[model samples]
Target: MACLSLDLCVGVLLLIGLRCQSCAGSKVYSSPGASVALPCGTRVHGPCSKISWKYKEKFFFFRDLVESGKVIDMKMGRLRVGADCSLHISDVSFMDGGQYMCYDGATSANTTLQLLNNGADEVFAVVGESVTLLCSDSTSPGVGESLRWSWQKKELITANQGGDVTVSANGKKTEFKINPDSSLAIKAVTAAHSGYYECSLFNDSGLISIRRRILLHTLHETTDLPSAPQQDVNFTLTCSLTCAAACDEDINLTWSHSSGEQQQGGAVVKINNTLISQLLVPKSQASQTSTCVVLREGAEIANHKWPVQGGKEVMYSTCSVCYPRFLTS
Candidate 1:
């Protein structure tokens, strides 16, 4: 029993050592203009094992023995390696997108590379308005070849059809023109003009990409009606009211005199209990101009022009009668 227990312990220790060695190296695939890191360790019984990097079956770096330092590939001079075997690639390109591998003799790992176009895709335009679509690549000002922009509308039968759109970027300014493409300018935007728009680039390598659906809306202007009447005197001057939708409640009513004095009157009731409001004036004050304003939830929504006594239903006019002050004789 003692011998069996000792053998079990040894087997467990051996399995742990194997797992640790396997965890020492890792592989990652990334797009061009992106960064990648390598893993390293000093787990082996004989000093730290050297780390090596590769791309597309090419040797990118081999560790230095004397200096114990990292190295980069001459072809990809921009790549950087740290003491810990991590790798970094800045401002990646389509060409740089690919497979990568890391190896430490007995241990090796591999990853596939993928390149992405970091370009703008969608263009938004209002109905009946003109729009321009732009497509570009992740290139610095003076580094890579200029990007060519092209657009296609899904409605077109073929990419080579007439009126196809094309554009080229000078630095950051993209100039647009039409070709067999339909994405350039729709003479006048309409309901039929709303659809999917795709923008792609044409470079040395033929790659086509697209941006998904964008919505266009047509906006219209509307007018609101005048508010209900507030205060009035003798009902000489009348108030007017208007609203976008029909009003429900009885509009509050009041009266005011030409001298700017206000008085409470009977609540103005809607004729036929309809939204329209009307208030009768005392015959004596019929000639005095008065204002009619509507109130809803303590807020004014509409107001008719101040009604004139014996005058046309205009906004403002002169008042005829002035209320006399009572004097004790």
Candidate 2:
């Protein structure tokens, strides 16, 4: 009896598959928090008196115009059916990806919905600094025992999958290393490397589970100071750090003096797609020197130093401007 039941189940599935093949397949692309309508059958088929929509063969909606319209097992209440037998879903999510079937009378149609996330998190890193791009499935954080991770930059030209299979273009893989957490750690970030980075998750059978992207911006800092200075003068020293885009971490700027004077605090920090830090100091009788330190994640990334112009003339032309009067004159 058990064998007979198994055969019957297979027969039913085969029949459903054949019915689905009668209608051409459709594909829809959408992101989370968006709404999409999946057409089950073209208008060639008149209004369906009896319509049903199923997800992977699991009933989701059933409507018999003459009988009744009823929602089935799914807890998500954001699904509805159009008079044309099309299924409309609102506030779609990652879990909503897969095959969907719309049954109208004796004819069945299928639609394959592809869910993509385009609003990737942005990251900014200084040139020559190391950075890690993150990708994860927080909505459905299911990591299979044999789960595999793949990393790609920009295009599919370079792909790394669990160290089992890798594709690179002329040693392009030398710059990036993948971590167990599916994060891509770049050894040294450069302007040439600024682009969209993607991470894909897979199962043991190499089936793609999820795909995400991260926008990385490689930044460079430039500092400007007045060429001429007078002693006991106040001037503004500006450091400009520019990137292709904005990042999550705020760029930290600190000012330090070489005169062994206690480093003063407070710098005006402004951020957008670019970061700017300004430091104001009083020029001393002797040429005082100060440096602007740019830090990210508590590590120094870039610095610029300038000699503050002093009122006193050098006793000798070759004297160091930033040195003390006793040592120079």
Candidate 3:
């Protein structure tokens, strides 16, 4: 009986040493909406007939306890047990941050998952409004991970030519301007700013700490819309537009007058930050419908028709003041 007890004690000590040497202090970091793998301890050998992944006592991932390579129940579809008995989680979230226990029938291995919260999908800002793209580091602040900011903008019109913007810790930009904060900010947004932007945080060693893709959209403002012009006095049909945040001046405005009226001086003017255009026509011709078009890079952003009747509704009158005088004579 004494010899049997000694053998049992030796077996327990060996198991403890194996677990410690294999994966006692495994730690990994994963960004939000990403995937991560937790390796089982080196002590785990032999065909993995059964595997389980657990948080605390709750089992979230289970493989064939009775058979090999068969999944019994997986609480989330994002979970998969690798052939090496590792736990691979897809689309990881902050809620997934915790200690994960991996059981390989005889013994278990544990790993710590740290989830970073720097993931932004889309951002919408009115033209001329300021916007900031967010990025954060989840690790403890004092852990001394030197972080730097890098921004890249994707061009929609061209597939080959691309631009990049980088902001250092001191708030200096390489090509474009950005806020000193870890977030990238655009003061005045324009249609040119509309594109896919990638923001990545990297350590001084050039390793990526966190990465996120942002789709930035800028809104255009079409205001002070024209109403139907009256048929009497000399009328001025006007269209006004607000300036884009990016201060893009590659914008054009034009007025299309009814064909019945001889064309007059129709001019576009910039008043302060607003683009205004006026079309002056004689009272007799003003009643006819006209069109106001605002275009940016050949794309019409604002199109309006005055006096809904449109140019097609114009009716030309053959008789004028001179004709009446002639008839009397």
TM-scores across all candidates?
Answer: 0.25, 0.38, 0.34
- Against the true structure, candidate 2 reaches a TM-score of 0.38
Best by lDDT: 2
Instruction: Quote the lDDT for 186 in model 2.
Output: 68
| Per-residue lDDT of candidate 2, residues 1-329 (tens digit) | 13245435533553456544455676665567656667655334665546666666343332221212244544467776555456667787888877776665566666788887654554555555666665564433345422233333333322455422234534564466666665566676555555556555433323233345555555443333346765545666565555444533755667677764535645545566555666666655236666655566865554545554444322111212221110111
> Rank order by TM-score, top first?
2, 3, 1
Worst 10 residues of 1 by lDDT: 320-329
For candidate 2, give the lDDT of residue 53.
Answer: 66
Candidate 1 per-residue lDDT, tens place, 163-229, comes to 4432322233222344333234444333333333434332222221222222221111111222433
Error of 2 at 40 (Å): 1.9
> Judged by TM-score, which candidate is best?
2
* Model 3 whole-model lDDT (C-alpha atoms): 0.49
TM match of model 1 to true structure: 0.25
lDDT of each: 0.36, 0.52, 0.49
- For residue 35, give model 1's deviation from the true position in Å: 4.0
True-structure lDDT of candidate 2:
0.52
**lDDT order of candidates, top first:** 2, 3, 1
The runs of at least 3 residues in candidate 2 whose Cα sits more than 4 Å from the true structure, single-residue gaps closed, are 1-17, 21-24, 42-44, 57-70, 121-247, 250-275, 278-329
Model 1 ranges with Cα > 4 A deviation: 1-32, 36-49, 58-69, 118-329
Q: Residue 27, candidate 3: how far off, in angstroms?
A: 8.3
